[model samples]
Target chain A: MARQLYELCGTDPARVFSPFCWRSRFALAHKGLDFESIPWRFTETERLAFAKHDKVPVLVDGARVVPDSFAIARYLDEAYPERPSLMHGRAHAYRFIQSWTGTVFHAALIRLIVSDVPPLLDEKARSYFIESRQQRFGMKLAEVTRDREARLPEFRAMLSPLRDAVLAQPFLGGDAPDYADHVVMGAFMWARGTSPLRLLAEDDPVWSWRERLLDAYGGIARATPRAEA
Target chain B: MARQLYELCGTDPARVFSPFCWRSRFALAHKGLDFESIPWRFTETERLAFAKHDKVPVLVDGARVVPDSFAIARYLDEAYPERPSLMHGRAHAYRFIQSWTGTVFHAALIRLIVSDVPPLLDEKARSYFIESRQQRFGMKLAEVTRDREARLPEFRAMLSPLRDAVLAQPFLGGDAPDYADHVVMGAFMWARGTSPLRLLAEDDPVWSWRERLLDAYGGIARATPRAEA
Candidate 1:
């Protein structure tokens, strides 16, 4: 069985965007492993029944199946021990970082760029995305991101820890990208693929760090399709 | 040149409460090193002149003087490499977690507990603390803590990352505590030593984690004097 990763995308399969999928994708690239991308869209639970999960970042590596970005990253590190380590055998230390990125960083991000996402999806996924998201937020899709420009400063302020760390070191993992870097940069990938609100200022260290990650691994992330604001 | 740690104290010498000093204290305890505590009060810059720092966490280890808490932790790991590793040779990976604790976690905490601190000091130190803190906050200390009870929910919400992490693993460093634990627990030490505002609810995972740390290293942190609210 060939290794394959299911990634969430829009109408154009070339544009992979889900933050969780980007984490798994970066983890694979960091481990120097090559896998084919299977573009999975929203509301495609039936397509993932083989994995017994409905997540986009489902990894089918030979006979073993893995779901969830964090689980897949750990699996990659364990399976490919000879490769450059993503967790470096301290995977548990990253659990807080993962939680912060998911609950705090990514939570702040969606409010700023969520409305920009629907148009990139196909008609069925677009409708499903809008309805599900609106129900989740208990508001109209546009209302969730209203006055986003005005709220950008607060969102950036929420990233004070990341900004300070990036300014002091090249990456959160330091000297090189690790699972910590993948966790954060995945959010940036989501922003890059879907939104054009210009999340980071030109002078910000995080912006520079993002540029470095985009150029990493032969510029795989940089080559992805971006939606202009 | 006996090893001595200059720790911030109030009217009672046992009431060492500086958050940064607690980081150094915990780091020292984690390394299983013995050091005498030199109680230093506010407005005692002349006492720290030898270290060329205006902080309380001055570690005079034999002929060497280390000032900052972060620096002292690094110095401890380097000075005693054979001891249980505090950073596990990845000090750089801790920068973001440290920044987050310092800026986001500690910043939120001081607002709830600053007013509770004045009564702990001597007359001169109390006056000095009041003037300096009021100048910093641009308000009376009491005003800074006015309705602190009402803000407890917001403060607890700010701890979502820590709570989630502790629930998943026994410590931020996994099975055992490390510098990451010291950095965050230092903030809790500050609260415990100075105020009894009940920062964490009895059932909070962070509360249990704090209990474990308090019992760690022969109950050094638990032995400190606390100001009941």
Candidate 2:
């Protein structure tokens, strides 16, 4: 069987937006591997039953199946040892970054861009997204992102760790992109693919770091379809 | 000359409390090196002039002086390459954790424990600490930490990343404690040295992790005198 990655997308198959999927995408690119992108939607749980996981970015590499992004990265490193390493045999060290991204970065980001996402989803996925997200936030999607423009400063202030890290080095992995970079850049990719709002200032060190990552891997991330022009 | 570490303390020489100092102290211990702890008060900037930095954690080896905790960790790794690897020769990969500890962890922690610190300081150090911290907070020390007990939940909430990471593993660096563990454990040491407040619930995963670290290296951290009974 050909190697394949099931990725999350919306109306347009090219618009892959899930942050977790983006991590796997970047990981695959970093490993210099080729895989067909199979666009998966929000309500596609049964479709992933073969992997026994209800998440996108599931990797089907030959007979081996990897279900999570971190697991996918580890699988790639283990399978392709000669290729560039993602976690450098220290997958456990990357957990803190993953935790921070999942809890802090993604929590803050969803509040800023959740309302902007439904328009890009097909009707069935859009309904599922809105209902699930509204229940999660305890309010309507629009209410969750209300005053987001005014909250941008607070959101940006919360990014001090990322800003400080990138200011000291070109990437979170330091001098080059690694799984840590992929984890963080995945969030930015979500914002880019869904929200047209300017999440970062042009002069921000994070902006520069994201630019470098966008240009890395032969501008693969940069060339991905974004909501913004 | 014998290796020496200049660490921040207050009225008692044994009450080494600066978070950064704890990092270097832990780093040194991790490397199995012995150093005399020279307690330096807050007002003693002149004492660190040889290192050309006004930091509490300055390592003076036989012929070299290293200032800054992160730099000291790097120095230890370089000076003793055969010792247990702290950053695993990927010191840059550790920057994000350092940044998080410095900005998010430290910033939130100070607000919770800053007021408790003055009583432990000598008069000159106490005055300097008061003035500097008050100026930084734009309020009196007590006012800065007013209603701190009521704010414990929010303060704990800010530690989600650390909590999540430790929940999944024995330490931030995986099976063994590395520089990342030291960097974060340093902050807890500062709180332990200065505050009687119960920062973590006994059942919290972070509390268990802290207990592990406190007992890790011959109970070095646990043996240190704490403000709490």
- Top candidate on TM-score is 2
DockQ-derived CAPRI band for the predicted complex in model 2: high
Candidate maximizing lDDT: 2
The digit string of per-residue lDDT tens for model 1 on A1-229 reads 8889999999999999999999999999998889999999999999999999987899999999999998998899889999999988888889888889988998899998899999999999999999998999999878989889899889989999998898889989999989999999999999999988888888887789889899988899999999885
Candidate 2 stretches with Cα past 4 Å from truth are: none
Candidates in order have lDDT scores of 0.92, 0.94
- TM-scores of the candidates are 0.97, 0.98
Comparing to the true complex, what docking class would candidate 1 get?
high
Q: What is the lDDT of residue B20 in candidate 1?
A: 91
Q: Give the clash count for each candidate.
A: 0, 0
The per-prediction CA RMSD against the true structure, in angstroms, equals 1.3, 1.1
Each model's DockQ score? 0.87, 0.92
Question: Highest DockQ, which number?
Answer: 2
Q: Could you give the DockQ of candidate 2?
A: 0.92
